[model samples]
Target: MNEVGVIDWGIVGAGHIAHRFAQGLAHVRDARLARVWSRRTESVAAFVQRHGGEGCGSFDDLLASDIDAVYIATLNDSHAGYARAALAAGKHVLCEKPATLNAGELRAVLETARVSRRLFMEAMKPPFFPLYRTLCEHLRRDPIGPVGLVRAGCSVANVPAEHPSFSLDTGGGALLDIGVYEMFLAVDWLGAPLDVQTFGRIGASGVDTFASVHSRHEAGIAQLFCGLDLDGKGDALLAGPHGYVWIHEKWWNPVRATVSYAGGRVVELNVPFEGGGLNYETAHFCELIRAGELESPIMTHEKSLRMISMLDAARSALGLVFPGE
Candidate 1:
């Protein structure tokens, strides 16, 4: 409850991503870690001890604490529930990607946030980064000279059965976990597609292990693939008549890019930063909350809903049905 000149933040869920967000907070001038809450009391206590913050025993206590915002880093299934509770309690919210299990859930959360007049934003990570902004600018300048096709993919070794990434009931799958990155970029660059065709191979747990999707935009097309059954270096390419931009390891905080064209010409761009790239999203969240804005022009609510709808269609095409849904 101390009056610091920064946005007081309480982090919910003590996971790997939560730690990254905490570390990223050090670089954000307008936000500070005020408290932490987790089902594992001892773990939350340890997090507070190490991070110089307080540990609360329950979500009620954390929400009632002197924090301006609640960062929900819990499992995907828990996002909507926690965010709704936070918004109802008069607090801003920054939730992790796949903010909800489906478009319906996203709609429900947005409706609740709207009714409560509170700010709610998803932590998609890439759109808020500097490199993506720069890339958008170049593309707008016709650097690519009329994009013809976009091919993007993200695939990694399957998670162990014990890992949360393998749980279907918790909304675990390549699409929500990693495919959204490629999908978001495609939509951001080319807008919604006229049609979407998808093919996926589901795991024994009823989650899609691999998905190959084609989005046909009016102007061009986006060919995207994501999987847990294969391991390959991920890249996103925006191709055009004149040149193409290549983003390496595009999903996990891209640091370098290459633009290549005919005549063996290549231009490499380096994205510089002071600390962890996670600062981008956190900083953007602070700005929006400080300005009393509910929606972001860059990462709009409509975009989130549309992306979820695409996933819904893809699931229907692949015959994927979550448990108890």
Candidate 2:
């Protein structure tokens, strides 16, 4: 942090998602973009010009800068390595979702955070949204009786073959890329699953282009569908014995939701925001650093481990294995 109390942030990637994240930083008053590093010099230069940051010649240069934390927006397979490096450099780490390729890699990163005594978090944005918090409060009050089923899906049209998300070596798949959002909502709301089943359509690249998962929780069941080869309705529903909650289109980053009782009583909510939804997570990360916290209570390490474990189980059931896994 500088003398003005602004936490300097170094970005580790210059991809599309990284651009979204940089845009999000504009809404966080306590944080400032400090440096950016990417293999592509032109990409990094453009990112800095738009986001008010300097372009580092290399990842090492970014780590050596006067930054309080590093926001890693790298490809799926590179998440663990960059996170470990940033932590070792004594900078807090905020890595994007699917924090690691598997539970084993996640464990290694967690161990590094412990040894380094630095804050580490998986940048799962949905859980940090105000709408999600409100829904959680309603669920706590049992406004929907006991939730018995959760149905959620997130899908998008396929990208070009050259995109990293389409390559198995880069940890590309519908599950790890988009499906984790659905999985997070289910696990966070329903707890760990006792039984898991999955089926997937593998593309020529040995990645799951489409996948469906069923997880049996103690109190209910969660049904999830995700794909990269097609488009979906992008919605989610939580139905209980006496009522249900409906998250509007693009449920993962929704701005609205509705709750209805069996008797026909209904209530709707609108969650307004500035910039992209990524701001919520960015602000929360800065808050944690200001408080000298090593982990986020909302997105705890155990929660990340559990999420990845479920992903691993589902992938195994579908016979979807990444390269060198």
Candidate 3:
């Protein structure tokens, strides 16, 4: 950060999620994408042209640039490497999703952040959304008692077989690509997983096509699922002794929810988001940068590790292992 309090950002990938980040950055105050790098020069050029950032020829160039933070928006397998490199370069890292392939890899990445004394966070966007925030506050004022059971899942059949999400070499699977989100919700609400029981199918691409996971957490139990070749669907439920909260379809990107009480009263929450929804997390990251914080209170390192550990266990149960893991 300069004297003006502006945070210069470097992006490691120029894919769909990166584009969403660039769009969301416009809404964050005093944060700008100063540099961007990807595997393809043409993709970098196109991204820079639209997002107004300097195109770097290599990942090293992006790291060497005078940027305050690096957003790792690459594929699942490469997230750990980019995060480690950026943090070692003395740059704060906001990695997309699962953070790393497994618990061991995430532990290594977290250690790097500690040694480098830089902020590191996984870009989990749900809890930062307006509706989620509202739900928390509402539950705090009223009483939902202790949330014990969380049920959430998402499945989609629109993705073609050629999509990177089904490629084994890239570490793409419904478990990591889609189930990670559900895992986050489970851990966030129910606590760390105690045991994960999974059943799924492996596709011809050598990745998981679908998975149904039943996890017992410290607080309660959660039932979650994810799929790449199924119909597009989902909703989430948080059940407690008093009542339950129902997050409408596509709960991960939640906008509306219904809170019911045992007293026969219902509360509806609807808080629409702006800037394509990624801005909430990006803005939170910027706030962390300005505060000189090493970790986010909401999306803590422990929560990330717990989420990935569930993914690891689920994958192991289904006999779905990546190439190098």
Candidate 4:
């Protein structure tokens, strides 16, 4: 907390996604950008200039500051290390998705947060979206009549070979990058799976270029597809005996949705939001911090752990392993 009763945030990693998160800070009234750190001084300087924050000489300097929370947006492999350091420094953490490379790493960081008594949450923006909230409410009312299947995909074409997204050492793969969103939707809708099966096309770099996962849950089934080497329709569909709901393209950051019943009636919803859609999560984080909460109700630590565990299983089935793992 700051002098003005707002949460002061220190951002780690000044990448493109980090800049978008800074843009989201503009839409949050209870949070202020306070400090930023990155391995490259030039990137940190640019981020500070564009986002109105002080540039830290190193990540240690940022953690040593009086910031209320640290937002980890670095490469997937470094999430646990930075989050552990921040928690040890008595700062809350909002790390980007795939909180760590595997469930084991996630457990370690979460244990540290428990001991430090600091709030820590994975930065999953969609769960806080108004569109998703409305969808959840409708589902709770049983309008869909027991959802039996969920199909989701997020795929992009032709990522350059040199991109970090294709490096095994960096924890690069379709599963960690975009597949996590699909997994989140599945788990949020159907709970953890009883069984998970996965198949993938591994690249020369040992990272997956394309992947498909199927999970069986008590409620029904979830099928997710993600790829860095192909284009996809980019939508998610939940279906039941009586009706179905369709989240629009880019389902992860959906702006529109439709619900259709067996009786030929359909309802469409358009969700309007501000500033890159990350503002929703930023605002929610501030609310939880102010309320003395350790995790988000919408995206709880348990949910994150389950998601990572599923990912770990999927990786094992697909025979995909990071360099150090």
Estimated TM-score for each candidate: 0.94, 0.96, 0.99, 0.97
- Candidate 2 clashing pairs, residues 3+ apart or interchain: none
Q: Give model 4's clash tally.
A: 0
Ranking by TM-score: 3, 4, 2, 1
| Highest lDDT scorer | 3
User: Candidate 1, residues 71-160: lDDT per residue as tens digits?
Assistant: 999988889999999999988899988888888889999999999999888887887777777766766764768777889998888567
lDDT order, best first, reads: 3, 4, 2, 1
Model 2 TM: 0.96
Please identify which of the two predictions, 3 or 4, would achieve the higher TM-score against the true structure: 3
For 1-325, candidate 2 gives per-residue lDDT tens digits of 8856799999999999999999999999878898999989999988988888899999999999999999999899999999999999999999999999999999999999999999999999988888888887877875788778989998788577777778898998999998888888888777777788898888888888899999997678999999988888899999988899999997878788999989998989788666788999989999999999999999999889878987898899889888778
Q: Rate the local accuracy (lDDT) of all candidates.
A: 0.83, 0.89, 0.93, 0.90
Clashes of each: 0, 0, 0, 0
Return the lDDT, model 3, position 132: 95
Clashing pairs in 4: none
Among residues 3 or more apart in sequence or in different chains, the pairs in candidate 1 whose N, CA or C atoms overlap within 3 Å are none
Which runs in model 1 stand beyond 4 Å of their true positions?
1-5, 262-264
